[model samples]
Target: MKILVCVKRVIDYNVKVRVKADQSDVDLTNVKMALNPFCEIAVEEAVRLKEQGKADEVVVVSIGPKAVQEQLRTALALGADRAIQIETEAAPEALNTAKLLAKVVEQEQPGLVLMGKQSIDSDNNQTGQMLAALIGAPQATFAYSLELDAEQVVVTREVDGGLKTLALKLPAVVTTDLRLNEPRYVKLPDIMKAKKKPLAVETPDGLGVALKQHQTVLKVEAPGQRQAGIRVDSVDALLDKLKNEAKVI
Candidate 1:
């Protein structure tokens, strides 16, 4: 089986965020970047399948600026066979991103496509599903575990209260969740090898997809600061405040 894992470059979760002075976007100067956390799980799972001899090849793909080649190289270090990058100055909206990926899917034609449930920077979980629609493939989102039979796939997904299962034929899309397998770090030897591995760059128009936007961000504001609560002298005072002042039972 051939597998294609869709990954993304995102701002490092640890870095402090600042809104641009013009209020158009986030300030990215001197900010750190990395792979999306959930996409890392998908990469790890693909590597495992390749190691088990269950998969023939695993390809990593991403859509972002040229700097994102580093993220794809990171996945190659972790064990993907090759990578392709769709170059853009900045990442676009979810629908446009999906349109870019659908072109890659059409070109590669891998039996399986794995991606993250959402990207931390945008927190938009629509790309994978939208790509599936564009490519005319079945989609299973929030997958925690994946299993394969002769020609079918069984995906276990995380739901609100419990787990749910879905079965799909080959050439399907699966989006990963947090409970997926823990990702492994790249060893020193693999890092050097990954540098020499194959990586191709193409533009969105070169891939024959016109980026389209379906949503807009009016503005981004800082979250409200939490206020400290008053301290009560005794249990009776607390109860009195809850019942009369705060109006809670």
Candidate 2:
């Protein structure tokens, strides 16, 4: 059976984010871009399934600008069989992205679908669940571990108190959590081989999916700077400041 892994291009986790001068959005010019960490974990899991002889193929897909192909290539270098790019100038919102992915799911008919529990850039954590609902498939989110059986897949997920396990039937959706698996390092030879692998590009219009904005951004602004703390001579002074200046007490 085939496994489809969805990935996203995001700002590297290490880079310090800067707000644009006009406060329209985060400044992305010359920013260091990388695959969403959660997406990498999802791709790694799909590749492992193929390596263990459980899956016949692992296909990686991303929805973004032409630049997203760079991330698709990275997924191929990590062991995905092929890549598909849904070319768009700007990233769509969570619901629209889910709709687009639903179209891909219908066309691919993979035995299982895997993606990040949330994209780091947006952190909406709704795409996978939304896609599951739209496609009428069972979904397991925040998956920490997975076991593939003949007709069903068991997933252990992180919950509020502890971990919970569920068995989902074939042709299901699973979103990877942070502890799912560590992504392997990309090798130089694999990078070269990925270049030769099949990479297809499709647009939302071609997929019959509309990229509509359900919400509007009123304004983007930097957070207020925190004030520095002042040292007090004794507990009395601290209490005085708290009662008078800070007014906590």
Candidate 3:
């Protein structure tokens, strides 16, 4: 099986975010960038499949600004066989990205495509689903575990309260969850070997894909802060507050 894993480059989750002066987006001027944490999990899962000899090859693909090639390299270092970057200068949004990925998916014709359920920077969680829809492939989102048989793929997904399983035909799409797999670090030798891995770059126009506006970002601001609450000295006091002071009972 040939696996295509989509990755993204985003501001590191550990770094504090600063909204741009215009409040349209976060400032990336000096912010540290890293692989999307969830996407990394997807990459790790694909690598494991290859190591098990269940997969023939792993192709890591990213659709975003040219800087995203760094993210693709990170996946290659993690054990992907090759990387493809659909270069774009447009701001990161779900529809445009899905469109570009759809074009590449047409060209690559991988048996399976896997990506993260969502990105840390933009938690929209729309790209993978949209891409699957465009390609007319069966999709399993938030998959925590996956098992493939001769003609079908089985996925255990994380639902609100518990897990649910679904079986889909081959050539499907799967979005991974946080506990899907543990990511491994690239050793020094693999990091050096990644330098020579094939990295293909293409533009939106080069892929014959066009953009259409589906939505706009009005502003991005810090989420509302929580107000401090009074502390009770004893269990009885806490019960009293909830029953009478707070008027719940």
RMSD of each: 1.9, 2.5, 1.7
Best by lDDT: 2
Tell me the deviation in Å of residue 204 in model 3.
1.1
Candidate 2 local lDDT, 78-99, one digit each (tens): 9999999999998889888889
Please report, in order, the local distance difference test score of every candidate based on alpha carbons: 0.90, 0.94, 0.89
- TM-score order of candidates, top first: 3, 1, 2
In candidate 2, which residue pairs get closer than 3 Å at backbone N, Cα or C atoms, i.e. clash? none
Better model by lDDT, 2 or 3?
A: 2
**Model 3 residue 229 CA deviation in Å:** 2.9
What TM-score does model 1 achieve against the real structure?
Answer: 0.93
As for model 2, its CA RMSD to the true structure in angstroms is: 2.5
> Model 2 shows how many backbone clashes?
0
Give candidate 2's error at residue 54 in angstroms. Answer: 0.8
Worst 10 residues of 1 by lDDT: 214-223
Per-candidate TM equals 0.93, 0.92, 0.93
Worst 10 residues of 2 by lDDT: 210-219
lDDT of 1 by residue, 1-249 (tens): 889999999998888888887777788898999998988889998999889888889999998888999999999999999999999988888888888888888889889999999999889799889989989999899998999755778999999999999999988999999988999978999999999999999998899888776677888776687999999999999999999999989
